[model samples]
Target chain A: SAVISQKPSRDICQRGTSLTIQCQVDSQVTMMFWYRQQPGQSLTLIATANQGSEATYESGFVIDKFPISRPNLTFSTLTVSNMSPEDSSIYLCSVAGTSRVSNEQFFGPGTRLTVL
Target chain B: QQQVKQSPQSLIVQKGGISIINCAYENTAFDYFPWYQQFPGKGPALLIAIRPDVSEKKEGRFTISFNKSAKQFSLHIMDSQPGDSATYFCAASTGLGANNLFFGTGTRLTVIP
Candidate 1:
């Protein structure tokens, strides 16, 4: 298991503002992912942050709206640009273990963003 | 299409009783299945996991039963306790290295003392 932490545990942002959430892991990891959890909903994969490469995003999400950067193995960031009330959700980061068979993931304490 | 489906959005189990949560997946490529537990104001934590090769895996009081032919799996918690009350999520992943998890809707389990 890995120790993961996210900055700005929470924040309240205006509708037009932007906020970047930072995720840091104690040890180096192979894969890092960003997720969004709406109120009373399941977790949605926002993107997969690749070290030294552009993040791979899933459908219903885009790079222009949710830009991501992963400079190294243990660090990544997700920036929600031009936020809106509908953008209010808990943003979480996770790191996948190196094991090929198991490959479990450890998550960071999410960043709760309340867009008003 | 929804990749993963979960049942019993909420559950109430008496202490020391059995707590069961079921999940099914549509993608046969998904080889990894994991159960995550989340408390209020925190991120989800990996509780237990299973691979396709195994029919069942037990860790202490928690057990995961996998039926590969049915494309389904379930989590069984023996001797439930109040501390076990939390939102449980079942997730599946293909060859994406477990980074891209297709999470189920989640089950809110309330174990009463």
Candidate 2:
């Protein structure tokens, strides 16, 4: 298993403001993904951060609203642009194939965002 | 369309009892099914997973039973404890690493002493 950490554990931002959440893994990883968990809801995949390439945004999500950057292995960032009250949710980062205990993805602590 | 479906939004099980959560999928292409546990203020943690080729997989007190023909699976938590109280989610993906996973609504399990 790998140790993953996210910056700004919790934050409150006003509408129209943007916040970039950073995810850093203790070791190099091949694939990194961003997910969102709405209040009292299950997680939803936001995008896949690819190294040296444009992130793959999932259906119902666009790059204009959520932009991702993966400069290299072990690190990635997701910026929630034009934040709105509906954007308030827990943003999580997960990595795959990094000492996977049982071929499962390891997740970060997640950044709790509250858009006011 | 909802790729995966989970049952029993909430459950209450007594200590030392069996806790079962069921999940069904609509896509047969999904070969990987993983169960995640989430605390109140934390990210979902991968608990256990099973592949379609296997009928069951067990690790410690957690077990995953898969029925490929029926397109269904379930998680069985034995010897439940209060510490097991958390939101559990069932997710499925066709591929690993870079593939996106479809998640269920989640089940809140409360193990009472």
Candidate 3:
């Protein structure tokens, strides 16, 4: 299991503003992912942040809206660009387990964003 | 396409009762099925998981029942407690590709005293 932490645990931003959430893991991880959970809704994968490479966005999500950066194996960031009221949600970062012994992925505390 | 679907948008169970949340997936390629529990103002934690090869898996008070033929799975919480009240999600992944997971709509469970 990995210990993941995110900065700015909660924030309130105005519409049209952008917020960048940072995720840092205690140790190097093979996989890092970003997910969004809308109000009262399930989580949706925003992208897969590969170390030293461009993040892969999921369908219905584009880089323009959610730009990601994974500069190293233990850290990544997701910036919600041109934010809107609908974009207010909880953003979480997760890392895949190192070995196949357990496919369990550990998650960060999450950043709660509220756009007004 | 949304590969996974979950039922019971919300559930209310008395203390010491049983709470069950169901989910179904369309992609047969999904080899790993996991359930996550999230408390208020907190990120989700991996609760329990099962593979297609097994029908059921248990850990503590949580249990997962997998049905390969129906392409469905469920999480059963035994001896529900007030602390167990939280949002639960079911997710599936192929474990081969990029390891991206498809999540089902969450089920909010309220364990009443």
Candidate 4:
């Protein structure tokens, strides 16, 4: 199992300001992902953090708003730009399991962002 | 399109009773089904997972019942306790690993003593 940690357990930011959340893993991983959990909602995949290239974003998410950078296998950062009230949510980073059959993903203790 | 569909937006179960949450997927390409448990102010943790090759997988009090033909799966929590109260999410993904997941809406469970 992979151990994951996120910076800033909670943050209150002003609207229009950007907040970057960092994620660190215990070891090298192949797949890293960013997700957002809104109030009383499910987890929505933001993008797949590729090690050397641009992230693969989901349908509704875009790079300009939620930029992601995976400099290496164990570290990645997500920046929430031009924040608004709607962007106030928990941002989490996850890593997929090494075993193919196990196919599990471990999530970091998300960063709760509250936009004021 | 919603790839995964989950039922019972919320559940209330008595202590020592069974709490069941169901999910169905429309994409046949999905092979990995995992259930995650999330407490307030915390990220979701993988509770139990099962592949399509197995019909059922259990870990302690948590069991994952998968029906490949029906494209559905359910999580069963037996002998529910107050500590089990939290939001549960069902997710699916393709391939072995390295793929993004499609998550269900999630179910809030309250286990009353």
Q: In model 1, which runs have C-alpha deviations exceeding 4 angstroms?
A: A98-102
Q: List the residue pairs that clash in candidate 2.
A: none
Question: What is the docking quality class of candidate 4?
Answer: medium
Best-first order by TM-score: 1, 2, 4, 3
RMSD for each model, in Å, please? 1.2, 1.3, 1.4, 1.2
Residues A1-116 of candidate 3 have per-residue lDDT tens digits of 78899998999999999999999999988889999988777888899998888998988899999999999889999999999999999999999855564466778999999999
Candidate 1 lDDT over residue span A1-116, tens digit each? 78999999999999999999999998888989999999999999999999998999999999999999999889999999999999999999999865554468888989999999
The best-first sequence of candidates by DockQ reads 4, 1, 3, 2
How much does candidate 4 score in TM-score? Answer: 0.96
Better of 1 and 3 by TM-score: 1
Top model by lDDT, which number?
A: 1
Q: What share of the true interface contacts does each candidate keep?
A: 0.70, 0.63, 0.63, 0.74
Off by over 4 Å in 2: A100-103, B96-98
Minimal lDDT window, size 10, model 4 chain A: A96-105
For residues B15-80, write the lDDT of model 4, one tens digit per residue. Answer: 999999999999999988999999998899989888899999999999999998889999999999
Compute the lDDT of residue B35 as modeled in candidate 3: 93
Ten residues in a row with the worst lDDT in model 1 chain B?
B93-102
